[model samples]
Target chain A: MAMSQATAAGPRRNRVLNGILVNGTLALICLLWLVPLLGLLVSSFRERSDITTSGWWTVFPHKSYISAKQDQLTKGLALDKPIQVEGVSLTDDQLRAGYTLPDGRKLIWANRRARIVDVQTSQWTTKANFTTANYQAVVLGQTYTYKQSDGSTKTEVGEDMSKAFINSLTVAIPATVIPILLAAFAAYAFAWMRFPGRRPLFAMVVGLLVVPSQVALIPLLRAFSNLHVNGTYLSLWLVHTGFGLSLAIYLLYNYISGLPREILESAFIDGASPFTIFLRLILPLSVPALASFAIFQFMWVWNDYLYALIFLGSTPDTQVLTIKLANLIGSRGQDWHLLTAGAFISMILPLVVFFSLQRYFVRGLLAGSVKG
Target chain B: MIHQTRDAENKRASSAATSGWIPGQFFAGLLGVVVVIALLWAGFIYLRAARSASILNAIVAIIWGVGGIGALFYVSNTLIEALPQKSRDRIRPFLFFGPGVVILFLFLTIPTLITLYQSFFNNDTTRFVGLSNYIATFTDRSMLESFRNNLIWLFLGTGFCVSFGLLIAVLADRSKFESLAKAIIFMPMAISLVGASVIWRFMYAYAPADQPQIGVLNAVLTSLGLQPQSWLTLQPWNNLFLVAVLIWGSTGFAMVLFSAALKGVPGDLLEAARVDGATEVQTFFAIIIPYIQGTILTVTTTTAIGTLKIFDQVFVMTGGQYGTEVVGTEFYRQFFTNRNFGYGAAIAIVLFIAISPVLVYNLRQLQKQEGF
Candidate 1:
């Protein structure tokens, strides 16, 4: 280990500085990673109006309010002497600026000359208010209600992105589940099952790994359309499955094959059928491999736009998260806050999934796939 | 001990194994009858033959859907019996591999044969165009450009991802803070491609003439008194920028693989080098590199293959805009978007052909390592 360390780099002090540089670089990276996420969380709290006008970070300590002069209608507290209104005591110029109104009237732009009236109060007192409306707009609410920076009340139509969020789930979960289930079984066959032409069959699948799925999209779509499966969750789910199965099976095969042969033999001798061995013995032992591949396939399909796009279309109801983000940009004209917020919204689930499952990655997938 | 266990298991195994093929037993006798009936159906279609294409398409579907399933099972079970007695005990495992074979054939092999046929046809899908499709792809400016850019993708994209990933993995190994640093670097891997594209879109964001650049990188450049640049829209450079995203995403994969390989390097080898009074840098070049050479080669090959077929990032980021077309992205654009089946097939062939060298090398290396 020490020899490997020496050849790889210098001693501890040198490594320490290298470590500092790496961590510093990573810290900057973390900040970079967090910006979009931070923007989302901040955007969730901010009013649509504020989001459009200022960056999310500008929200705190910036003190945004419309200020105006409110004439104390009763002659502005006339003193006992009732001094003549010399120079219009406390003239409009002296009325001071920046005030909020108790009536919830926001001052767009104010000048001292404006005065309060029964029907119209131009005199705006500084009003600083915060509400949970933005949160409602994002989670379990609407996309259109979010205000634009250019002071436009933008409204989204037809299927809400949130519905597509569920639609994405409908596509993603099945696309993920079906392939892993199939692959786990296939991987077992490739790994432990004694079969004629096993190598060729496994090779065919692995060789397909290099055969890009982009090649199959059109024909598959045509086939699906002919089968009346086009534009259905079933279509995209199958597309993901067909595309994912090769790699997933290969990866799982490696992990399963790497397991000690004795356990499997023991199971076989106990009269446990193949299915029984897989269910009771192999499956539990292969948890780490399964988790890693699950993370992999989940992330891949969840972020996938092409398969979903080609098979599912731009139909708002069937759009996956990727398509939704694409539309948000194309239609909304780069509403940064909303895009950031929406981008982060789509990512939260994947992040949690990857972070939680990443620990299992230590098992060395490639180890089994290749020989020592 | 083994013999005693084997007899106990045989009683349990025989029943379970036979039960698994019970459906096959049921179908075995009926298959002959069904084939005769199916021929009659085909003959009926042949006689009506006015709608031959529709019938032909249906026949294709049935062959793929039904015959494909049957073929897979028959092939799988037939092969199962051919293994030596030592390996024959793996019957229970073969059952799981059944579905993977079916999906692989249905999706990959059949489609490949179809693509070969399609490459000979015209855009309308009715006329055979011979070698003209492949010829036009070579002569056409856009197709040629996509090929050139894909080479750039293969060389530079995979090149950076492997080198940088190896650099990071080597540095992070044997460190106190290894896991945390790796986690942060791997964070991008967790994000969906869309989310990463969105995050990067902000980082590479360009606004019209006078707008303040919101992308962090551009923001920094402007802050540094340099003019803001449109990173993604820059013709040649945009390809590299897109590649950067791939590097960020795939480096963790390379890192983890190399890291695992690093673990397998024995410590005594390194200690011997140290006792020889080898300098730190000398030790790395002399000892570590050679020890982990197999893994480095594997990582490089895997990453190279990955880059050869990259589509998602480019498709999402720029849709192959600004002369940044790659084979994977261009194949989709040609076949599906433009409805040009011949050109798409030609490009797909090119990609498959291009990846063959690396594939062969990887296979050979994998075989040599595995002693298969």
Candidate 2:
């Protein structure tokens, strides 16, 4: 009894230590986890040049710099000619630009490197500049004028997602609705209907759940072309519905089959036809399951790339947000601001869906994982 | 004569109710289904014939898509109602399960068979080359590199996602900010893999040492007086870099699952262990972990499956350059870019074969959980 009492305080101390260690580690990890997302969010608001010149963390009070070299001054500096730099006269040819003398004035040069004579210099200073210009450019397409490899300037509209957003809706709404409708019916049958092949068919659905979509891609495309539906939104609608059916049916069956068997049996005894039971009783009670599966289907279809890339070729009108965002990276990867903004734009809908329907999202995930 | 008149009156009364609702339901359903099909057909034509940028096409497509599927279900139910009662009883399950089964068989099963057959043919799918394509897939240098990269991704991505998820879940359990911490970490799961790639690409951004370093990793390195490395160009490490993106995107899913499992761990067991003078560390590994071991295996397999099928991050970030190719991207390249249909089909088959064992194991686990 004395020994037990003595160790009580020691246990309390250990509990306190455990508390701090656990919470502290979790807090640190949470912060680190947000870093990459933060980088993108911050970079999205920065100017293109600032994104290229410094890290997104350094967005506040950015300092511009200009460096000078000795060889450039010797090659381009004219003897006995006065050079004007940031309203300061440089009479000496050897001084060059970006030279900090013993005075308060520090000479800097243009942001770009050029010949000494062509390098117009300026005063170095800090600017707290931030802009929504990148977003604006993305939303309202910018006509970019860039020098071509053939030494000709070409003007083209930068890739934007305003139209692709509509395209995603076109693909996603049907994709989500079709699969759910089909799966709900199949689930109802699998759950309540008396069928000879129920167990084997359900097993097949489970098997199909893990079939890699890659195996289905080429042949499906060929079939679509044969059906004269390739490169159409309808094609993707069918493809997604078919591809998603296995999981949808599996999830819905899990929920629908578990409904109180007594209620269904009683309805059957009351001369309620299977059709009426499904239309009236099963549909209403299955709303939560339906909603959860709908959310999953919507999110998956919205974020889908491979199907969109293959079926909805990257034509301006047919491309979804994901396709546009990907093509933007492929063509103009160095434009970090544009890339980040475009990425965030693509994420906006899914994030909203995720946050608003998080309960269903979590339920659906649990059903998939815990049950599996 | 009096009995006949009374019977006629009763028959008339019952028929009046059926005539009122039955025809109205059938016509409305038929009209809706027809309109939906018509709109979809027209929309497909417009997409192909006109510019894809038309908003009208998108709107029409969505309306037809969402409305059409629902209308089809209604059509079948109303059709059953319009039938003789005996026929209706025989056809109800077909109405429920037919559409889903037919779509799956057409799109998934048929396509799978076609691809399997095509894998035996040549690039143009003309000559029957037998297993030469599969042999090429195994023997080519680039193919070997892709296989190596996929293995790296599978191990590193699955390892980090499950372990980190478990760690975070255990640490954050019962913390005051548990929900908040989990929400932030879970945010990336809402973003597409392409978006995640864009975010991480910024973190691995690099510039010449003389120039300002924009990438966070490179920037941090230069600040520490180390040379900035071209992260994506560094072989072996480049593959790891891509794997990191998958880990980042997937950890949230694992964490969510693990957190739920942790919540299900018996609290009384922990209390009992504590009363037995077991330290928190000992209790954690002994009581909590063993309880959630099933979840750990489930999450690990889930993540590994996802990692094996990973395509978006690598497609967007590296394009399989600098020895970072994997199976999914390689399939895309061979099929779409290189136009090597046979080789692409073979690569896809390899991916499908790799997933079968995992799929069987997952299904077995699910069967156990559901007790079916």
Candidate 3:
């Protein structure tokens, strides 16, 4: 009895150790994956000055020790009154103009709070730093007043992303819906209907699956220009539909063909015409497949950058979020405040759809990739 | 027996057909075609006119683009039903499949052929320049750099994604928090490459050595008593940094696929190995890896294709500067910025040729599975 109990205890201990190892590894990887996104999320909510001055992880409430010169201390502060630093009283105007400290460290005021700086470092504690201003600036235009070298104030307006958000929706909806609709019909034909060259045609689609879109870029650009449809939403919608058709058809075909043969045979025996049977029976029965393809197409079209960039162009009137965000990275490379918010805005919709209908999305992925 | 049943169904379909309405049905079909064309044209015009960013314009475009296509399919199907049985049978499949096929031919196949033909022409396409563009693609200095960088991205990016993905998937499979862990890792797949660049841009943000390092990476380096590095501008190694962004964004895709493939490994098989005194590591390498070998290939090729066409991350992060140039960016620069049509077309064709082996492999796999 003791021998059996010892053997059982050994395997149990092994199982416990195995569980810890598995969970520990997954937790580490999960943390690694989450940190970058978490940093971006945190930075998006931070004030512009804070983003430029410190790492996003610093936004966590903590005590910071840092040495700063008087000029460096005055940069982000908006002082309202005179303050005494190491027995020297300094007014707001004096601080703004320039103040020199004997030891290059002094008391500084920011956001109506004062902290002492030492020759080595200063002790400053902060609550969790947070702000919604970055999002406001990215979604709604923010105006900045800068004093130029000539002492003239210049007001520059930041780019508003609300319009680009709308443009992305405009591009994604049709680009998603049209291809699925067209591919559903084609997939049905490929699955159930007998036609000449159907086998070869279906094979051709599978071949087209790996044809990189780069090959079509130049000629299509020329064609669009000649057709006077360059930089239009219609052009993007058409191009996306064409590019997305093969996979849409392939995934839908896999599901539609696997549907029980009895149902189709019974509908035929009942003398229902092919089109009616398709409309009344096949389509309704194929909802799960249709839904999987819909989610796939929607996400693909929403997250598309290359096609949208090349086909739609980056004009303010037509650019999608990907194009707009990419442009922000180019023109405002240093504007992390705008970029973090813009990037979040661009991903929010797809993220929402992905989380909500993730089962269908996963189903689509498995169907597309693991046929065997 | 199947052929006889099909013949009987055909006879029944013919008997149910309404005769003596040929001209009316023909005109009705013509009218349906015209209506579809007109509706599509109107939607296109409205979409083009709504270049201004407004919620109202977005709503209108969605309705017209989506609703208009829906109406076209409905009308075409109805008109086809009105035709006599002989014509209907001959035309029904086309009615379902025509639009998708036409779009594919116009947007993908024909344009790819045009790009191939244009590759033989001069920059302006006014003269034949046979093989020069191809030679330049091979011999050009910048092109060679792009090829080398692309090779780096292809191997490193695909390798990291697949291995990390396989690791995460395998570990998560045995955890109680499987869904949540998988969800967090999979979340990045929903983000666009542009958004991912922005996210990592914050992670890799750098400051001068004198100032506090704002980027997390540099901040960690400084805290560890190391000199901060400019991750993006640090040549040669910068390509790896950019490739890291791709891996971060795509590993989730590989993981989901691997996770699904892992589930397909029979529980009993794993149990048998464990009972046979095999260690987990031994079982993983001996049993699990071989079981999922096909999925590994699929994930590798898929990720490789994506890396080969690496554009958005490189464009947004480094703009292909600091020796991080790849074929996708090179194609964009030659085609759009430089207006080197022949050269750009050659680059695109080169990309297509590079992908053909994988394409052929996928086709062969599909043929073996479906017995085509």
DockQ for each of the predicted structures, in order? 0.25, 0.45, 0.55
After superposition, candidate 3 runs with Cα above 4 Å error: A66-124, A144-156, B1-23, B53-87
Compared with the true structure, what per-residue lDDT tens digits does model 1 show for residues B1-372? 645645554653464455543344345535644654465456334423222123233344334333434444444443443333344465535556767778788877788778778888888679988999989988988878888887887788778777776766766775567787677667777677777777677667765435555555665677697888889888788888888777777777777777777777788988898899897679878988898887877777677777878777788778888988877887888877798887888777777777677656655554663514
Ranking by DockQ: 3, 2, 1
Across residues B216-271, which tens digit of lDDT does each residue of candidate 2 receive? 89988998999999999998789888888887788999999999999998888888
For residue A298, model 3's alpha carbon misses the true position, in angstroms, by 2.1
Q: How many backbone clashes does candidate 2 have?
A: 0
How large an RMSD does model 1 have?
9.9
- Poorest 10 consecutive residues of model 3 chain A by lDDT? A110-119
Q: Which segments of candidate 2 are over 4 A away from where they belong?
A: A1-12, A60-127, A142-159, B1-59, B78-90, B365-372
Q: Compose the digit string of candidate 1's lDDT tens values, residues A289-358.
A: 8877776677778777778778887776567778888776667636654666677678788788777777
The numbered model that scores best in DockQ is 3
Model 3's i-RMS, to one decimal, reads 2.9
What digit string (tens of lDDT, one per residue) describes model 3 on residues A1-372?
999998999889989999998998889889988999998888888876677777878766565545454322444344566655556878765544345567645444322244323323445556366878777788887864444445587666767999899888888877777777778788888888777877778877888888999999898889888877878787887788889898988988898888899998997786766766677777898888888888888888888888888888899877999999999988998888788988999999999999999999999888987772
Q: Per-residue lDDT for B1-372 in model 3, tens only?
A: 545645665664464464623566567767987988897787777777656656576567667755766677777766776667667788888877777777788888999999999999999888999999999999999999999999999999999999999999999888999999999999988898889999888888888887878788998999998999999999889998898888788898999999988999999999999899999899999999999999999999989998998898898888888888899999999999999999999999999999999988977777786535
Note the Cα lDDT for every prediction shown.
0.66, 0.79, 0.82
Which of candidates 2 and 3 reaches a greater TM-score?
Answer: 3
Q: Could you give the interface RMSD of each candidate, to one decimal?
A: 8.2, 3.5, 2.9
